[model samples]
Target: MRAFIFPGQGSQKVGMGTDLAAASTHARELFEEVDDALGQRLFQLMREGPADELMLTENAQPAIMALSMAVLRVLEKEGGVKLADVAGCVAGHSLGEYSALCSAEAIPLAETARLLKLRGQAMQRAVPVGEGAMAALLGADVAKAEDLAEAAEADGEICTVANDNDPGQVVISGHKAAIERAVAMVKDDKDRWGIKRGVPLPVSAPFHCPLMRPAAEEMEKALTETVIVAPSAPLYANVTAEAVSDPALIRSLLVDQVTGRVRWRESVLAMHADGADHFVEIGGKVVGPMVGRIVADAEVMSVQGMDDIEALIKSI
Candidate 1:
């Protein structure tokens, strides 16, 4: 069995899909469609970036999703691979979930792009700049990270584990002070917590925490108006870490995902438990390594450009 997983934020680049768009007409058309939907030449921005504007949450969110979908379309149209037939279940990291839903036809491509644009804008505006922050808890598991997060909270400041990515990797998000406190606690008590170091993340705002309630509310309004259908492939939700086929549940979980932990490790384990032996990381190569760490015995592959698509096809 095979599982298809998509990547989230932090995987974007200045010229993400330029090669693919140049190589495949399908890929180019998809990019054109997205640009038309958003009423902006996003592809141009993606291909030639000043870095700052493309790095904006609003831009990165939709841009990454568009590139991922472009890669998937290339695989389907040029490589003769069908995601709905090959992937038993699908999962994604944070924003990657939107890509998965779009690839599976659960959500319209244009709607997904627009929703992510709103989501990115909302998340960016949720907390004032310098007021919130995020950090990566290296050499720490979820339980240990949670304990460190609780110990790091200062004066009721919000600090919590955001992404349980792999065995020794976890991310935390919250108030800037609390994040600093968490890193300090881990630095001072590394032996007790088994934390190597808490490295601060270069992010616009603290995401996947209570501080993002405003973003969640904004998503609630946007998702309510958008049409969603059941995905052809079951999606292992980031909030629940379980496969869900119900469209209503997927929508609710997406709303919750704005302020919920990305249970990636558990979701990968669940897919493995269901007899998935091959894991395909679509959109970006970042999540592919984490999946390999989660299920050591499973075959892992990442599909990004034309070479990656050919390799993935050959591997299967």
Candidate 2:
């Protein structure tokens, strides 16, 4: 069985979808439609970037989704592969969930783009810059990362594990000072913590933690008003790390994901356990490496440009 996955934030670049748009009319049309839906020349920004602007949370979220969708559209149009017929399941990392849903036709492309823009804006607005921060813990599992966070967070500061990415990687999000303290603790107490390093992430806000409750509330309202249908294939939710197909359940999970840990490691393990032999990364290569760590024996492929897509079609 083949499983398609989409990448989340931090996977975007200046010219990510340009090659796909150039190679496929379907991809170009999808980019144009997303630009129209957002009422901004997002494609232009994506094509030519100063790097700083494209990296902004408000811009990066939808930009990542747009590239993923554009790639998916090209695959569908050129490869003669439809989601319902070939996919055993679908999943995405963080905002990539919207892309997965769009691939499964659970949500329209325009709605998916608009929702991501709003989600990014709300998440950015939830915390002031430099006040909240996120950090990556290398050579540490979720349990050790949690202990490090607990030991570091003092004076009522909030710090929690945000993403359980893979076996040796975990990310923590919380107050900037708390994050710094966590880094110090992990670095200072090597024997006790068993953490090789704690690297701070460049982000506007501390995401997927309790600090994002305001963002979660905003997403709840937006999702409630948006139209959602049952997906063609099961989507492995970030919060649950399991396959879910019900529209209402998906809505609830999306809202919760704002302040919940992204259990990507377990999600990949679950898909691999269910006999998904090949895992195709649709948008970015960020999650592709993590999938490799989770299911080393499974055939993992990252599809980016025309060559990669064509090769994927031939391989499948």
Candidate 3:
């Protein structure tokens, strides 16, 4: 009846998990463990940011996971809530999937932190700066976005829809030229298709398209070398938008997700169909609202700190 979800990359902020670490010993332990695993004080960067360093893909990945896991630990240890008992299923957007897996016990918290750090670094290094970009097409569905992308890919450049986020929000990523072309096309034809907005995202590289195949290959090798276990709760994979329990399948899906469209909209629908009435977003508030838009009748909550966690515990 309840589904716990985790947020991805863009949800991170400078001082995200500080309050949680201050309020709960369990949360503090989670942060300490992540620091030990990564051999660096990621928590320090998260608490006191130089802004630029924390924003780097490599640091952002594990930092976000550390915050989410800290919150999860507080909820379970202090709030007296068991993950297996309260949640029917779990899901997350892109990098959030790693957080969800950690929450489900498919991977240890330390390993999740390390793997996410590697994943972020690989993804960041996959494309050069200014050469690749991503944009959001608001009020446009996947079909229209695809048409626009196809129309804009004629200049020896690659452009493709990357994230099918929700009904009216789709994100495209590829070469900067192709993305610019696609944005122009969308803006030119905005009134014809009821598209009211087209906005470019602030990202260092294009992600989740065929352009990220190198990152996928890198992840494949990294994943094979890492240990993955059957999750305590089913994980709704980003590629399939379906619950996957088998470890091998999860590994394959993680590799595939790099070059595959993140079916976030479909994943929410599938979870709704599977009888999830409540959706709790960990780490940030972005996905909770998106889930609300996808499933209008479902109850949604986002937890960011000790007060929010306490409020959630009381509400649940």
Candidate 4:
């Protein structure tokens, strides 16, 4: 069986979705719809330069979702590969959860765009710039990373694991001082902590930690008012690392996900255990490699543009 996955924030770049928009009318229409929903020329920002603006959390979240949806639209319309027919389940990393739901038809495309825009803004607002930070702990498992975070925490300064990306990589997020202390601990005692290195992330906010409670509250309010339907395929949610289909449960999980650990490693393993041997990543190439790293023999492919879409159609 196959699982369709979506990429998250960091996968975006300056020229994303441009070729798909040019080659497929479905892609073009999807981009146009997203632009109209957010009332901004997001596609132009994605295609043109000015990296700083495109990198903003408000822009990157929806822009990444739009690119993923553009790829899915092309695959459905031009390639005749419906997600419901081909994918046994769906999953996404962080912001990609919205993209996954859009592909599964639980959320409308335009609404997904708008929600992501709001989600990004709320998350950015939850923490002030230069006060929060995240760091990547290389060569460390969740246990080691947690221990490192505990060592770094003190006097109400919060430090906690944000993303358990893989066996070798874990990300932590919290106050800038706590995160800096964690990095320093990893550097000062690499052998003691069993960590090779710690690299601070270039993110605007400390995401997926207790510090994001305010953002979670914001998401809860928005999602409560939004209309959601059951998805065609079950989603392995980031916070739960388990398959969920009920719309209300999905809604609650999404709100919690803002301030919870992204259990990506466990989610991939759970998908593999559930008979999804092949994983297809739509629109971005980042998650495919992570899947390979998680499951040593899992077949993985990433679809980015017309050529990749056509190739995937043939392969499927």
Q: Give the TM-scores of the predictions, in the order they appear.
A: 0.98, 0.98, 0.97, 0.99
Question: Tens-digit lDDT track for model 1 on 1-316?
Answer: 9889899999888988999999999999999999999998999999999689999999999999999899889999988998997889898899999999998999999999999999999998999999999999999999999999998887889999999999989999999999998999888988999999999999999999999999999999999998999999999999998999998999999999999999999999999998888998887899989988888899998888899999988876
- Name the better of 2 and 3 by TM-score: 2
The reply for model 1, stretches above 4 Å from the true place, is none
The model with the greater TM-score, 1 or 3, is 1
CA lDDT for candidate 3 = 0.90
Per-residue lDDT over 1-316 for candidate 3, one digit per residue giving the tens place of the 0 to 100 score: 8999998888878887887878888988989999999999899999999888998899998998898888888888989987877888999899999999999999998889989989988998898888999999999889988888887897578889899999989999999999998788767878765666779998998999888888999999999998999988899999999999999999999999988999999999999999999999988999999998899999999998888888889987
List residue ranges in candidate 2 displaced over 4 A: none
Clashing pairs in 2: none
lDDT of 4 by residue, 1-316 (tens): 8999998889889998888888888888989999999999999999994899999999999999999989988898888889999899999999999999999999999899999999999999999999999999999999999999999998899999999998999999999999999999888988999999999999999999998999999999999998999999999999999999999999999999999999999999999999999999998998889999999999999999899888899998
Write down the lDDT of every candidate, Cα atoms only.
0.93, 0.92, 0.90, 0.94
Q: Which stretches of candidate 3 lie over 4 Å from their true place?
A: none
Sort the candidates on lDDT, descending order. 4, 1, 2, 3
Query: Residue 245, candidate 1: how far off, in angstroms?
Result: 0.6
Worst-scoring 10-residue span by lDDT in model 2:
77-86
- The residue pairs in collision within model 1 are none
